[model samples]
Structures are given as C-alpha cells and as structure tokens.
Target: MKIFIIGITGRVGSLLARSLQDRGDTVSGLVRRPDQQSALQDAGIVAAVGDLTALTPEGLAELTGDVDALVFTAGAGGGTAEQTTAIDFGGVVTAIAAADLRGIRRFGLVSAFPEAWRERHLGAGFEHYMDMKKHADQALTHSDLDWIILRPAVLLDEAGTGRIALGPAELHGDVPRQDVADTMAELLHEPQITRQILELNHGGTPVAEAVQAAVRR
Candidate 1:
C-alpha cells in the first residue's frame, strides 16, 4: 500500500514511516522544510514537502495525489495556543477535507486521550493541547472517510514491548512510541479495523492480536 504521513519527521511519525517501509509498503512523508527532505529519503520514504497548516486544498490535493491513505501526526509542539490550534486542529481538518476531495477514504489520526474534554483543565498547557486534540478527533469522527483514531496515553520514547491494550475502554498509562507505531502498521493492513477510536498503552495482548480482538468487538 502507498501511504502518506503528516509530521513524518517526529518520533512517532518517523517510526510509523519506517515501520511501514519495513513491511514493503510505499511510504511518503510530508515535510515542511527543504532541509528535512534528505532525512526521509535516507529512510527510504518519498518526501512530499509542504506546510499542511497553510496549504490550500489544491496544493494539498497535489501533494497527496494517488496515495492510498493518510496518517496525521502533526502538532505545534509547545507553541502558543493559536499555533497549536492552527497545526493540531486546523491542519488535520484541512488534510481530511483534501483527502475526501481526492477520494482517499483511509485515514489514521494520532490523538491524545480526551481528558480535558471530560474534566475542564482550563489554563494549563495540557488543557490547550487536549482542547486541540478533541476538535481534531471530532472532525475525523464526522468525516466521510474510513477513519481510525488512536489515543495513546503519555508518550514515552522507550523501546516497544510489541504488546498493548487496544480498545475503546478507558485505558490510561504511558505507551512507548514504538508500540504505537507497531499498532499503526497493523491497522493499515487490517481492513476489519475501520471507523473506531482505540486507546493504546504498554500491556496486555500482542499488538496484532490486540488489534484483531479490538476489531471483532
């Protein structure tokens, strides 16, 4: 399968891109800077360079042209609330609209747990982050595409255990970035896993087995 990943240079995004490539899939990464192109190429990913936060629908259509699916992991990364909203919420929304226009139905969104939505954690840095996350997830939830939203708990850079708890149940804990990437790679190949929001953490069944079980739910 041919897949495009937004924010493919980041920790989770880069892992997902490389993991897909390892599985013999054609992986393309959307890079915002010219200097970033070589890194993706080095990892054997086709580099589609453009700023999703500012790209028009036409430009986005061209960038994502002929791709089979899109995985969005873009974020403002501790920037101001406006910038966070622009990239986290606005960027994903634009990509989703562009994907629909291009007739791409498969989308994967990397979002955080909706802790802020449940309890108002106003004024905290985390509150702003979750607010943006809530909107982005909602946009995907209502889109025409076949979407899977993965809400992982505190992201750790530790090595993957190749296992996880994958479901809609209220799972809370830290999850390694690599484990999240593992689940994403499996989700892409499993057509049975569409239109669901699942939480990921470091425990329980093996990643693929957990995914299969989650889809059967």
Candidate 2:
C-alpha cells in the first residue's frame, strides 16, 4: 500500500509514517519546510513539500497523483481562532478537494476529542479550538470518500503504552500519541472502518487487542 501523509513531520504523523513503513507499506509525506525533509527521509518516507493552506488545484493534482490513501494530521497549534480555522478547517477542505480531484477516496483524519469543543456548559475558553476541529470533522463527514475520523484526548509524550480504547462519541479519555499513530496505521488497512468518527483513549490493554475490540463494536 502506498500512503500519502500530510503533516508527516508532526509527532503523530512521524510515528504513523514509520509504523506504516515498518509494516512494508510505501509512504510519502507532505512537508511544509525543506528542513523537515531530513526527518521524513530518516523515517524512510518520501517527502513532498508544500503549504496545505496554499495548495492550488494544479498543485494538488501533481502531489496526489498515484497515492493510495491520504492521512491529514496537519494543524495550527496554539493559534488564534482565525489562524486555527485557516489551517485546520480550511486545510481540510483543501485536502478533500484535492483528493477528490485525484480520485483518491480513502482518507483518515486525526481529530480532537469532542470534549475539547465544549463551551462554558462543559468546559470553557477552548471554543475556538473545538470549533475548528468540529468544522474540519464535519467537512470530512460529508466528503465523497471512505473516511475515518479518530478523535483522541489530551496527547501525551510518554512512551506508547501500546493500549487503546475506542467507542462512539460516548467514550472519552486521554490517549498517547504513539498509540494514536498505531491505530491510524491499522485503520488504513481496514476498509470496514470507513465513515466513522471514533474516540480513542488508553485502554490499559494491548494496542492490537484494543483495536480489534473497536473493530468488533
């Protein structure tokens, strides 16, 4: 399987690239800076550099040609509402349009847990971030493609516990970045996981088993 990953230099993206590559999949990553090339290269992933927010029709045509699946993990971290919308929401729209043009229907997204979007009623001051993520997730929901949205909780840098828990919007909790990456890689190979938005967290169990349980749900 050949995979095209956006934001491949990101924490989760880097891990996903390596995980896929190790499992014998050919991986290509979309990077924003030439300096990020080495990181992708180090992970044995081919790098294509461009700004997701600025992708033109022709640019998308050139980049997505021959790719099998696209995983969008790009984001504008800790930015103002406008900036967040530009990179997160607008970026997703751009990628979806580009993918459609190239007829690449398989897509995966790394989304935030819905709780992050809650306002004063649930939580406060994260409305902007939550709205940005919500908009992006909703856009993907209506896209003409096979897609799965994985919304994980507060991402931790701790070494992957290799455990994962998955449920509908009903489930909530934090998950390690590494496990999130692993789950994304696994979902890429499973067509049945399409058109679903799954919330993920640490299951205190093995990663593979947790994923299998999610699949069974």
Candidate 3:
C-alpha cells in the first residue's frame, strides 16, 4: 500500500514510517524541516517538505496524489493554547479536507487518552491540547471516510512488547511508542477496523488479537 504519513519526524511517526517500509509498503512522509528529510530517507520513505500549518489543496494533491491511506501523527508539541490549536486542530482540518478532495478514505490519528483531560485534570497547560484532539476526533467520526483514532496513554519510549490492550476511550494504561506504531501500521491494511476509537496499552494480550476484536465490533 502507498501510505502518506504526516509528522513523520515525530517519535511515533518515525517508527511507523520505518515499520511500514520494512513490511514492503510504499511510504511517503511529510516534514517541516529540510534537515529532517534524511531521517525519512534513511527509513526508505519518500519525503515531502511542507508545513501542516499551511496545508493546501495544491500541496496535498502533490504530496498525496497516489497514496492509499493517510496517518496524522502531527502535534504542536509544548506550546501555548493558540499554537496548539493552530497545529493540532487546524492541521487536522486541513488534512481532512485534502483527503476528501483526493478521494482517499482511510484515515488514522494519534490521540491522547481522554481520561487525562477529563478525570486527572492535567491543568490548562494541556487543556487546549486535549480539547483540540477531542475536536479532531469528533470531526473525523462524522466524516464519510473510514477512520480510526488511537488514544494511547502517556506514550513511553520502551521497546514494543508485541502486545496491547484495546478498549474504548475510557480505558487507561501506558503504551510504548513502538506498539502504537505497530498498531497503526496494521490498521493501514485492515478495512474492517474503520470508524472506531481505540485505546492502546501494554498488557498480556497480543496486539493483533486486540485489534481483531476491535474490528469484530
């Protein structure tokens, strides 16, 4: 499959790009910095330098012309509420519009566990981030395209365990960045897992089995 990955320089996005390429899939990555182009090239992915903040139809047509699926792994990182909304919320809106125009239906997003914002109350520092993610998820849910939203609890850098626990948005536990990447890679090819919000965490169950169960639902 030809896959277009946004924010491919990010921790999870980089891992996913490499994993997908290793599996013999054609991978295309979008990045902001020209210096980061080598990273995606090293992973055997075609790199396109562009800013998500200014994602346009012409730009998207050029970047995503022949892609089969799109993964939104972009974020504003640590910044003010306005900045977060600009990149997180606004960037997704642009991507969605581009996908619609290009006739690409499969979409995936990296979201935060909602519990962090609703129950734990991580404070205003992260409040905008959470709201932006939630709004993006809601918008995707209402779109006609097939979509999957993976909300992983505070992502960790540990090696993947090849196992994951999947549930609704309320399920809570930490998951490795590698595991999230693996799950996204698998979903890129699985059509049955559409229009679902999956929460991922490290656990005793195999990741494939967990995803299969989610697909069954």
Candidate with the greatest TM-score versus the true structure = 1
- Where model 2 places Cα greater than 4 Å from the true spot, the runs are 117-125
Q: List residue ranges in candidate 3 displaced over 4 A.
A: 117-121
lDDT of 2: 0.81
lDDT of 2 by residue, 77-177 (tens): 77666778888888888888888888888999999997743433633326777888899999999988888899998788878887777767545656789
User: Would you list the clashing residue pairs of candidate 3?
Assistant: none
RMSD of each: 2.0, 2.4, 1.6
Error of 2 at 99 (Å): 0.9
Against the true structure, candidate 3 reaches a TM-score of 0.93
Order of the predicted models by lDDT, top scorer first: 1, 3, 2
Q: Which window of 10 residues has the lowest lDDT sum in candidate 3?
A: 114-123
Q: Would you estimate the TM-scores of all the predictions?
A: 0.94, 0.91, 0.93
Q: List model 1 lDDT by residue over 109-135, tens digit each.
A: 999866524454456676878878989
lDDT of 3: 0.83
Task: Give the clashing residue pairs of candidate 1, or none.
Answer: none
The Cα RMSD of model 3 versus the native structure comes to 1.6
In terms of lDDT, the best-performing candidate is 1
Query: How many Å off is the CA of 8 in candidate 2?
Result: 0.6
